[model samples]
Target: MKKFTFKIFAVAITLLLSTSLSLELLAQSAGYEVLFDGGSLEKWRSKSTPSSPIKGWKVEDGMLFMEGEGGGDIITKDKYGDFELVFEFNLTEKANSGIKYFVDTIYNEKSGEMKVNGPEYQIIDDYNYEGVKEDPNGTTSTGAAYLFYPPKNKQLNPHGEWNKGKIVAKGKKVSHWLNGKKLVSYTRGSKDYLKKKTANKFKDDKNYGELKEGHILITDHGDKVFFRNIKIKKL
Candidate 1:
């Protein structure tokens, strides 16, 4: 009886280990890479100084958060061309931030400013933020393509709550999703895209929205925001 019991327990343990290993392998086979799992910043760097360690962002209680000013922005050290990115964020009152993809540094000759330009997945306190409240359904609202396209059918969670954000970029097409619902979708450099691009703050940036391999960035808009479960899969 003792020998039989021991055999049964060993088999159970082996099966458990096999199941866990199978799940992990499945995740990898699907091409998913975890950018942040609350532990290290090995995959990220400060945007301003790519060679240096990140500032203003910290890992606390399994979340990556911006604590104060002068943190600038942070971007992935590895650039991606076509991928699906997902993350969860929590916002403080009136907080403003964004996740930007296809990000690249550009020298704006017209304004004489060096800027990191990309289409932003706008995140803000939609009900309380003055800018968003003024134009609740406008291009600057949460889930917007940041001055390019306004999200439709958005169901934003209230301030101090968590929200899920997803971005899928493949070829010249990109889509933004909030809470598992698609909010914005557009093709870069399309006729309609060009029309909007020429009329916005990025008009002077002739290369803005052009498809290219670029880094993913988390903006530091001088507000408190938390992000976690950041993952990406190349498609």
Candidate 2:
């Protein structure tokens, strides 16, 4: 069946020309709640480079939007173990963005600080990002494990409009979807997820996606990325 989804951060917000759904209300008992309410930032934090937090996100037209460049990583102040996240996103021609969960940002030996390990729900310009130019890296694709798992289809929508995204994280299992298409699914810390990790550049990072609980993060990779209707139902 054809399907589509979006994110409804921890808070609630309404928008013009927006399609409303109860991904949150429907999942109320399931621990579902809004993350972005078009209000001030309370349960959120930002880290532009490494652990250095920056400001670049705001709410507009009922949607949580990342304004003019330079802003860094904006993440939820709270942490979670198991949950379902749904958000709506739209980008510029070559816009780059993504939602990351199960994040355990810690310091590395060699590097002063970094997002040590966490499973990220892939998002990007599929066909228009800078990767399609300069240096081609699978990590920049719309639905790849950011260089681990590569999405087969170019189902990503064109920049300037909205595209639905979903992330399901329960225990050792994780899944990603874009525009209602399955991009990747694997059990966290599982042999399968571990196998792929071992084969990729993340092999050395034992902490990668190993978190049994962590916070949510939104990456402001220097491009325009808008999000809204962010809701999460914790399992």
Candidate 3:
């Protein structure tokens, strides 16, 4: 009788551990998909020419590093309507780059030129950037919503250190996070959003921020920047 009781207890403990492990794995991969896992660009391509091979992006030391001169912006082939994106980036001094979403490709009939337009999450060496240097509070600094909404509380790491970023968009509501801190949150298509859009360069484009579903973009601003751990979860 004693041996049978011990055997039953051991089986129960084993089952419990197995169940817990399964739950943990499920939680980790519930709805998330790894876009770039430091292997290849299977899920990305040059936004300029989606069918052609990527021009200047490279995988180096397990990170997606871009030289920015010849490497144009890369965009995900899949379009996201409402989702959450997370990535890590490290910048060089005086570098300027951005993670742009809600990007819609448009062609101007008059000029016969194609353009990619969206709101940018600014990434730069704020202190060294000449355009934003005068603004001591970092209105256009790292993590700002480009020209539309400036980050009020931003914590940027040193030039070489990695910084975590998150962008969550559901319906018209959007939020930007840097290093686990919420920097900006606003509702798109709202009265304030329209007013702000009209004040920027995007004012000339009617369909700039009105896209319901569009591609995610990593802009190459002629600066050296490294990015990794790019993942997204659709809501």
Candidate 4:
């Protein structure tokens, strides 16, 4: 009986190891690379000064969180042309933040700050935030493309709860997803997009939203927010 029990335990251990190996292989085959899994910020850098270490952002209790404002923005060191990005975020009450892709540096003459420019996947406290409460369906709301495209059929978890966010950019088409639901999709340089760009604040900038390859940015919107499990798969 003792020998039989030992054999069974050995088999169970073998099965568990096999399962873990299979999952790891599957992720590699699917081209998924982990950018952050609560470990290191080696893959990211400050957007304004790439040479300097990140400021105002902390990694604690297995989470990469913005403690308070002035973190400046953080961006991935490598650039991607077409890819899929997935992350999880938790917002404080009335917090505002975003995940931006196809990011390029632009000199803001008004602020005298070199800012990263791109289309943003809005992350905010949708219920209590005054801006989102005022226009629940507007482009500024959570899951929207930040003044460019508004999400439809949006369902947002309340602040303090984790929400899954996804962005897929394949060719000229990009789509935003939240909590397994697709909220917005648009093609770059499409006629409708051009019309919307002309009507918005980016109209004066000819190269706005026209970049083909750029970094991924996490905005610092002067609020405390938590992020984790950031992964990207190049497509």
Tens-place lDDT per residue, model 2, 1-235, is 1232233421223532232334434546466777874444555777424335446777666667678766677778778888888888887777777787778667566865555356666676766666645535555577666656665554877888788888888778777888888877767776767777888787898877877788888877777777876777777
Question: How many clashes does each candidate structure show, in the order listed?
Answer: 0, 29, 0, 0
**lDDT scores in order:** 0.86, 0.70, 0.83, 0.86
Candidate 1 displacement at residue 100 in angstroms: 0.6
Per-candidate TM-scores read 0.85, 0.76, 0.84, 0.85
* C-alpha RMSD values across all candidates: 5.4, 8.6, 8.1, 4.9
**Model 4 C-alpha RMSD to native:** 4.9
TM-score attained by model 4: 0.85
Judged by TM-score relative to the true structure, which candidate is superior, 2 or 3? 3
Worst 10 residues of 4 by lDDT: 16-25
Give candidate 3 misplaced runs (Cα > 4 Å): 1-28, 107-112
Model 1, residue 80: C-alpha shift (Å):
0.7
Q: TM-score for candidate 1, please give it.
A: 0.85
